[model samples]
Target chain A: MRYIKNPMEIEKTSFEIIGREMGEHNFTEAQLQIVKRVIHTTADFQYKDLLEISEGAIEAGKEALRNSPLIYTDTNMILSGINKRALGTLKGNAICYVNLEEVHKEAKEKSITRSMAAVEKACDENVDIFVFGNAPTALFKLRELIKEGKAKPKLIIAVPVGFVGASESKEGLEELNIPYITVRGRKGGSTVAASIVNALMYMIVER
Target chain B: MRYIKNPMEIEKTSFEIIGREMGEHNFTEAQLQIVKRVIHTTADFQYKDLLEISEGAIEAGKEALRNSPLIYTDTNMILSGINKRALGTLKGNAICYVNLEEVHKEAKEKSITRSMAAVEKACDENVDIFVFGNAPTALFKLRELIKEGKAKPKLIIAVPVGFVGASESKEGLEELNIPYITVRGRKGGSTVAASIVNALMYMIVER
Candidate 1:
């Protein structure tokens, strides 16, 4: 707020404000951290109610981070916003394959969204965490792959915001029996997804 | 497709793909450029029909870019994604005041979104182009300020994507006489907003 040039300080100040605004809201520390990051990104407090954090998603995320699992994101902004230094310490890599030729070719061949193709490609990469911030189709594809036993990620961050397939994709996540952190309706993006990843990074390494 | 590392080359390749996909569609050259960038970012060809580019918006944007006018954005990602090197060559700056302390304080006092407060702050900065990617509230507030004769921007890029006020906000943009590039429904974000800016940059300087 005070012309904060240091990214870490800016992030911390945002969390403090979020903490103050969330007074009396009941949530676990890890869930609260994710909520704070989401609020920090959108400045929308309704996320306090809309955000659905699974009982052990944060724990799963932390364990995945500790094991240096690859983080596959649906958008480059999510990849760019992650705490790279902290993740680097854990040997984790934040990867996004949205614009690759293979993805485009597969999407065309399979009659699917490029986001879906990207998720399919990510399945071959040993993904530990799947972060779908901008693409509901990607989240849907991930859910399908997980249910079919073709992919097994420790955690899923599904927060694709849009009128089309956003709510339904998150609903699909709920039925997967897999650990996930998601919002119920259409209210998320790369920024929110990246913030969740940062929260996980902080809990696993910074905290 | 070929693991293109050069940003310009990557952009050009995207344009090529967009050109192939848009074989029979009739659009002005400027409109095609904007559409290409939007598709490049989202990988969604449906944008061909969803996006609406005003006849004068690109011309207005190119003029503003050439004049080194101040650029206002709704999110940090939009600010960061802009080609700063080209902008610096033209002596312009991409500004996002949403996270500033002043915006947070004013938003609290006014019971408005920080994005709205940030737009109010930009009123004093002589903003030439207003790019709203993530905040419908910000776009709504800007419209209010413009109607009240409190602020005047040469061009507006209204593409806020979400379920809430996204469509209604873009509808508000249409009522204004100033030129704008907007989507009809709920589909947009910082990535699309940044792509529009990048397209304008390429048209003005990169080419």
Candidate 2:
């Protein structure tokens, strides 16, 4: 499908009406795909219009987060890119990683061998913005951290476009009381989700 | 790609040199597609085979659970379905759903204007077994619940299979401190996860 170019107008008009902005929010490729794809595929002006509105809300979220301290979800890729891509963004924060083994405590033998409990560690440290490149479970469980008073990221940027695994993380985000952006209706992966959050974080923090 | 007709055999024999047993206690979907789909079209079998070994330990968990009660992670679709499909299998035990409003509290405004808190309540009150649907997050937050004194389910049937948005939870069943059953690689859903748990419970509770 062809991508929609320059969704700024739709993004803006949406904000003016319902206060859900997308134009201003920084978005990764997958997130952009959702917004653009949804607009392209929508037959109804209402749904199309809704996409515009969501975009605008995303934009507002971006604006709200402009120049904010940011931290990437410490997945393998993002964690690896830290020195290269996260130099400006990570600021003074330590690229967080969860020692599931350490956290697993007494149940060490029985539980999940997490690649790295990056999200949990981020929350435990109370980082400003917890970015999920595509760790849906991390995004999913963030709500719990927020609840237990462990992890509380201001804005959770998730792009669940063209993916199946972490795509449903929107539900988790909603559950966690975090603000997020999705293309229109699609699943997503870690790289794309990270890209979108990165875009927004760049707009907000670096811009 | 075609779905594996008899995944059990592949899981037990060919996938790995040594068959996997039930998972360790702690650690750690349905949808558009009828069967399981993955990020990479190929080689998922390899991953499945490894996860199966982890899940085979469910019997140990069953024994542990028989001695105590089961705790839930939060309110989720899989956990909610246990009452319906699983009622017949599970009996004579104190089954509780972890009241989880904290996870969904964040996305209150995005989902058809429903309250995340309400959904969490429904999920928390749903059932004992999470049904182990939903793609597990890499962070393995479920470990936190068990370790932090928030949750303590005895027999966990981890089927870390997401039909679309959900992952087959059984793969990470090892992350939890409970005895978990990681079924065949792709057999999972609201119905599938529930049935397996119910069947297991029946095997246990009936006799």
Candidate 3:
């Protein structure tokens, strides 16, 4: 197996894996189309293979989010990726995602680690943005990259989410000089971040 | 009141807020000692005032987490914090902390929001052995900082981070380089990250 470093390549590989998994689930045509778009975006583009992969992953992820809303919406599952959480935000108006539905201690094909795995994917793919939820080490690395001028994330949000609001994450964003909006402290959550990103994506892509 | 961006100040505020809101539950001397130790270890030790304030706030936070760990431990909460429906990792001895008493969201003294607010307490107070059961956003921000070289946390975890692991919050950490840990998927509301972190702290601190 090849070591796929680019976000796009990683996304493409992940899409294929997701496709395999979704294959048994019987997705709708629209869902299938979105999945295909994600796969194609990550797989087919040759000009900017890496960037395309990341974009496709985001799109695919977006579709996954929109298509499958969480039935119970457990916060632990959101934390662990047992289910999907949907939300809304003002910035970009895109319904971005953070794949908490697949998180687990073991790195499996059908796990949230795939989404976190996107960081290497983005880095290798040289994607435009490297949006992350709350992987402290990953964010630390991002900070390192920013300090070295080796990374370019238009927005880097480390919104401090507590039992109350999204202020700390907001502060992190402010420090990073990335334009971001959070749920104001306790209001922050995976769903909140997803909603914000999703809303942001909708704003940009829909526009 | 001066605007302090320090972690201690943030945590102190959280303690005061939670303590006041939660019928003013004061910390015992032993617990207060632990709080002080956490403050000195996690916080910068520079903001004496913030540290002083955070001591109270952190104790309040620990009290809250122990008493009601599930505030941030919901699938929706986890998803909202991590921004993904799934996560996977090979490490991160994570755990899920929840208040076994099952209080309604409205009747609860500590909401998931407030628990997350105390994250800065751990960081600001220089408290090394800190734990968060449901505060996904706080966890996310911490991860982001670590990834970006803003914070250098040694360990991060989620334990039943949500009710019954109803929604896992460790997905974000699964993707990063941090020494993360969590319980098995579907092992909802278990002491996965909490126990592990405590164990780790025991191992490291006792050394």
lDDT of each: 0.78, 0.39, 0.34
Write down the worst ten-residue block by lDDT for model 3 chain A: A44-53
Candidate 2: segments with Cα more than 4 A from true spot: A1-74, A80-110, A113-117, A148-150, A160-167, A183-186, A201-207, B1-38, B41-207
C-alpha lDDT of candidate 1 relative to the true structure: 0.78
Winner by TM-score: 1
How do the residues A1-207 of candidate 1 rate in per-residue lDDT, one tens digit apiece? Answer: 112323345456556766776678888777887887677655557789989988788888888889867999987778766767788889988888877888878877876677788898889887999998877667767777888899988889988865455667788565777789998876677777888888888876854
Best by DockQ: 1
Winner on TM-score (1 vs 3): 1
lDDT (Cα, tens digit) per residue for candidate 1, span B46-116? 67888898878888899998897799998877886677778898899888997788888998887778888
Candidate 2 fraction of reference contacts recovered: 0.00
Judging by lDDT, tell me the better candidate of 2 and 3. Answer: 2
Better of 1 and 2 by TM-score: 1
For the record, the alpha-carbon RMSD of candidate 1 to the native fold, in angstroms, is 10.3
| Interface RMSD score of each model | 11.3, 16.8, 17.9
**Deviation from native of the Cα of residue A192 in model 3, angstroms:** 2.1
Instruction: List where candidate 3 sits over 4 angstroms from the true fold.
Output: A1-122, A162-178, A182-187, A201-207, B1-23, B26-207
User: How accurate is chain B of model 1, given as a TM-score from 0 to 1?
Assistant: 0.94
